[model samples]
Target: MFKHAHFKAHTALFLQATGLTGGPGAAPLFSGLDLQIPTGLTAVTGDEGTGKTSLLRLLSGDLSAHSGTRPATDALWLNLALPEHDEATPEQVWSALQQQCPRWSTELQQDVTEALSLQVHLGKKLFMLSTGSRRKVGLVALLASGATLTCLDQPYVSLDQGSIQVVRGFLNDMADHPTRAWLVADYEADPDLDWSSCITLG
Candidate 1:
């Protein structure tokens, strides 16, 4: 069993930005933004093209902000939609992820796999699965990672209602832990989520 640490090492993420602009000559997507996301579930909501994706990218260090500082995180996981490898099956990719991710949890992996009903798709190649199945595989990876801060972009993209319910249940359960944080940016709000905080961009 994973012990929930009562004391948070630091805030989940903090960004002090004068603005988040695109490339040179491009207008700022969002300006004068500052946030201190705490250790719990946070929902980033806003209209499209409002820098929601940019904000998440900056937090995960996948994209740099024009004038902002993203604090260091001890363990961070960013949701990635992997490309289809002709020969790679879901099982192979999952095995590879387990080997590469330092915070990977076997117990959590099993739990998510079962919760999402992913066993049927495990042996199928990434290209063979439906969109929802592929997304579920990625969800399993993100949930099982056990990172201190996990950033998920559009987690409910292709999920069915049943699978979405399972995800919501898992998130509700994970919220009990005092140390880990989940940052989700999506266009639509999940009515069932009990968010620690909700931020709107633009």
Candidate 2:
């Protein structure tokens, strides 16, 4: 459980689309969409093929909108999908995050890594680790990042019950942050989570 604190109002992300289209002959996902992500937690929920993932990718600048323009969001952090790195060890990935992500915090990294019980698999290569372990590595980096906006796509996937609980707590803790905004996109909403706002996409 997270400590309840005063909620502050701040806008960390703004998205607008006059007409956005992609996939299968450029079908439009959403048109005239406007979203303002303020400080706190927001949940994006919808069924599969509803463009929940696509919206996150657009926000993260991983996918381009066919029509609208999004402002530069260098401070945004998202962990939607991880590319296969067969030869990379969890330890190696951790080291790379230290150098690549400017907002990476050592203290936060240690806390998340321990909470996720990722130490046991740090020495193992990506190919050798279980799906849960691999996700933990990415989860650590995502939590350690001190970005203004953090988007997590299906974060609970492949996680065991214990790890899922840990991540829920971590996300709750992050939701209390004054400057950071947490956005989650999933097939269904976690009933345990206290979302400040929710958008159902289709």
Task: Give model 2's clash tally.
Answer: 0
The TM-score that candidate 2 achieves is 0.82
Q: Candidate 2: lDDT of 128?
A: 82
What tens-digit string does per-residue lDDT give for candidate 1 at 1-202? 1111222453343322333344222565544455666667778777887667777766666665666555666444444345645457767776877776688888988888888898887888877888888888788888887776777888888998889898888887765457777878897557887676676664
- Alpha-carbon RMSD of each model: 6.5, 5.3
Return the TM-score for each candidate structure: 0.80, 0.82
Task: Identify the leading candidate in terms of lDDT.
Answer: 2
lDDT of 2 by residue, 19-97 (tens): 3444223666655465666566878888888777777777766676766656666444444245556678866776776
At residue 25, give the lDDT of candidate 1: 29
- Shift in Å, residue 27, candidate 2: 3.6
Error of 1 at 13 (Å): 8.1
